[model samples]
Target: MNGRNPILAEAPTEPMTGISLLGTTALLFEAPGETSLAVQRRIWSLAREAETWPEVREAVPGVNNLLVTWREPPRRLAAIVERLAAAWETASPLALEGRTVELPVVYGGEGGLHMADVVAHTGLSPEAIAEIHAAPVYPVYALGSHPGYCYLGGMDPRIATPRRKVPVLRIPGGAVSIGGAQTGVSASPGPSGWNTIGSTDMIFFDAARTPPALLQPGDSIRFRIAGVVR
Candidate 1:
């Protein structure tokens, strides 16, 4: 949303050559360009492929990057890089038949502390904002801000607003918020720069669960307006 990282910003104009090493233990595969379904699908595909490698301990996807990490750094980093490049070359856009999770939200009340600000920025009524937001079946781009938190793509640009210049100390879990061109659901209580527009009851994470994360990469989300909070 803040634009691609400097390393990737200038490269989208050219062909996606391959993955590059972030350091000794991680590989960063740059996305073709801005966050999109095609790019995210490719990233998720590469992540799944990297998991097949014996050295990879985790493969985390970002908005426009794929980061693969190893428990123990490989001795021949070049070999790993080459292997990733090969995988990228043959990788196809992942066919993710992911389940759709519908989240019921109560918009514009005490929970949505920044609702007024959002209304002011977008010049839309609270109801209009909620309608625009809930209309799309957003793709889960990546999970990163906090455990089980989702970075969702496909927000209506009409409702898009920049993050708060000064971040709030803490927002409750299940907070539906927006930052820049992206919208997301918070999974835990934490500091955030995004503006909260609503709150949902959907549980995002539970340590007792086997996978812990409720939403996986490639999944889709639909928000429903339960009612207004106030």
Candidate 2:
């Protein structure tokens, strides 16, 4: 195991280009190679290109994957799949220079209900954990889980912690959390399997506003240490 900490996120069991059916409504394309920003950019590139296809209703990006939804499964599915593989070969990283928003976080006390759990797992002090978590300018990889929520990338690996065994019934909005190799702040929470270590007061979604989500893929979040709980 190279004597590395076992808390690290596991490697992908499936590799190379893979296509699967998410029911019959959509086809999911999982990109091969390491899960890095470059790969993510390639997924972004694929999404942009795939969206223009007459068959595609929408091309949604995920962490190292793309979901292309359609009104109905195309009749020439095999040909479409072949074309998708061909498209992936030529797809290149699309640099999306987006807005950067800094969020002030409170890294313990009530906000961090699971702070002790993370401390137990990672063997890092809360302060150290906060510092490591705050170190990176995380990119909004994609949005999922709930409305206006974002899936972020670029967390430091030292503090990697597995998702909770059992999800909490509900976590407060603005919860800054970690689940395995990634982390993000919850915009509006319901249930989450991630470890909550901190929180912010940012209102990420407002239905009354146009383009309700505060951040999109390619946007950035720099977490500022507003306060740390001892």
Candidate 3:
């Protein structure tokens, strides 16, 4: 561990916080701060670069930071850390080719089991909430937590809110939700802390599908409310 926050030293240009984990075979960089659109995009870009390194096993990015796993032994751990640090110093734009996907959501009522909560927080009725969520096109920033899971941006601030105090244990596949300033679709059944406002029929991830995740980093997503479910 550097004893200093990596995000503070590395990403000083942005209001991002970071932490470093010391290990024999790998070093981890964690950026802890307010989750915003720009911060999440930058973090994903960093992960894309880290993926090119032969020694790197996988670069898993979250809302604000990255967890870089390496394939080398503990002795090479320091060297890998130095490489990652230097990359941040001269970070360049990622060349990842992304695609766009349209997701249909059935917001409010039965489709959105927690639409009432959104109404409570924003004082927007279920109908208005659906309009707001579908108003803007969102950009996929990262895939996280679980496979085919996406972190998105471009949500209307009116609907932005904190995650649920108690997370749902298992949301059905294709659940659409908002957390912080972003909105996303659940590719598989999993626990989520975000506010569930609706669901989509679009399959985000499928093991049987040739390219599992329906959306990738940099893809655009627009939601279409299926209809009110009685």
TM-score of each: 0.87, 0.90, 0.80
Q: Give the poorly placed runs of model 1, Cα more than 4 Å off.
A: 1-23
| Maximum-lDDT candidate | 2
Model 3, residue 117: distance off in Å is 1.0
Instruction: Report the lDDT tens digits of candidate 2 across residue range 32-105.
Output: 88888899999999999999998789999998899998766565566666778899999989999999999999
> lDDT score of model 2?
0.87
Candidate lDDT scores, in order, read 0.84, 0.87, 0.73
* Best of the two (1, 2) by lDDT: 2
Q: In candidate 3, list every pair of residues with a backbone clash.
A: 24-74
**What is the C-alpha lDDT profile of model 1 across 1-230, one tens digit per residue?**
67544333333344335566575567677866667888788888988999988889999888878889987767566566667778877888896887799999999897788999899999999999999999999988888877998888889899989889999999999999989898998899999999999999899999999899998887999999987654
Clashing pairs in 1: none
After superposing candidate 2 on the true structure, give the runs of residues whose Cα lies further than 4 Å from its correct spot.
1-17
lDDT of 3 by residue, 117-183 (tens): 8888999888888888988877777787788988777788998878998998988878888877777
What's the distance in Å from true for residue 90, model 3?
Answer: 1.1
lDDT of 1 at 226: 88
Ranking by TM-score: 2, 1, 3
**Which parts of model 3 have CA positions greater than 4 angstroms off?**
1-17, 31-41, 95-97
